[model samples]
Target: MRDMHESSADFSDSCIKEEVLKEKLLRPARDIRSILRWGYPKFSTIRFVADHFQLSLEERHILARVIMPPDRIISRINKKIDCSEIKDRKILIDGYNVLLTVDSLLKKELMWFCDDGYIRDTRYYFSKAKQAEDIEEALDAVLGFLSEASPKSVFFLFDAQISRSGELAGFTRRKLKEYKISGEAKTSKIADFELKTEGGNPESNVIVATSDGIIIDSVKEVLDIPACLMEKMGIEPIRLY
Candidate 1:
């Protein structure tokens, strides 16, 4: 067993290493943003910066998710709505996108607020098999927030291509009822497209709950549920910038 002094030393060393690593990433993160703003092809510019910086695969993934051109970032930020704005509003939730980000946060995985002012995770798309309990835990946080926010109604849309997505939708519906929130959950063959379509509708006055860039770009108003959840949990996301 390590003594307290030894443990303190270890922790001090860990913090120092993290600060050093962050310092190393600072320039590359800035340059990537600058080039992206200049209309360079995103993939090639990232690759070029990564090569120049000798960034690992993990670091490259961070740049891909966390950095965006300034205009795009500003546009997304403009769409962002406060939690108070969600009350008595029809919310179209990108179910899996919100869930996975919340799941990553609950598991203490790599999650961060990108330059675009939304929370994102670096996890592979559907890379991990989600157990029922894990899904339940994530939903608890998701629905609990909905309950507190007092939305007029909620609609959760899941990707139909994911295995057992219909089942997940069913589980979500049951949970919604249990939380006494007026909501429905259904799987969609093109959930992202549907989210964009619904959010773009001028008649609906819809408020979308998602961190997806494409959907955010299309939607008039956006909510970052995981970011709200993180605030409630007092967890400051990792800052790549």
Candidate 2:
């Protein structure tokens, strides 16, 4: 086995080298961004981007997060509200989207700072039991911040299709209560569709909380709550190829 001091030096060297690689990814990310802006499907673009970069699927996955389509999408993403602006506004959280992003932060999963500067993550597919701890951590992180923001109200929407979603909704309500945050939890057959409608309505005074690109585009305002927390904690995205 390596000595402790030797191991520490090795870790430091590897860590710096990894950071360099992540920085280097920006080149390919720009290329991929250009490909996407030309109306290419991301599915096809992803494979082509991966092949062009000569990277593994995981590397491509992380890179895809950073590479996004041009202007229209970027403009929509820019409409998101700053974390500091969340105070006193009613927030409708894209529950899984926000929750999973923070969970990924904790797991050191791939995070992409999109062209418009908002951060996003992709890793919501998993069994509930396997995600219990992450779910709890994610909820606590965002709700705790909202508690500080003192939002007028919050609405947490989960996907009905996911197993134990109802149970998770209940847990979320209790957590809101514990945090002294005002919120209701509901499971939806299509949370995205519901959130799109609700958050888009000017009369609702509801700001969305999600990193989902589609929902972000549809809503008038968004709060990348998970992104805020991750940044606050100096939690960097995972680097693995």
**Which candidate ranks first by lDDT, i.e. highest?**
1
Over 1-241, each residue of candidate 2 has an lDDT whose tens digit, in order, gives 2224556777678567658767767667766767887888776787786788787666676666655566556577667787788778899998777787777766555566666566776553544443445479778878878888888999999998887788888889888889988879989998889999998898988999887777888888888887678667775554332
Report the Cα lDDT for candidate 2: 0.75
- Please report, in order, the local distance difference test score of every candidate based on alpha carbons: 0.85, 0.75
TM-score per candidate, in order? 0.90, 0.83
Give stretches of model 2 more than 4 Å off: 1-17, 20-24, 35-43, 122-134, 236-241
Clashing pairs in 1: none
Q: In model 2, what lDDT does residue 192 have?
A: 88
Off by over 4 Å in 1: 1-21, 125-131
Report the alpha-carbon TM-score of model 1 versus the true structure.
Answer: 0.90
lDDT of 1 by residue, 47-148 (tens): 999999999887888788888877788899999998767889999999888898888877666676799899998876455345445678899989999899
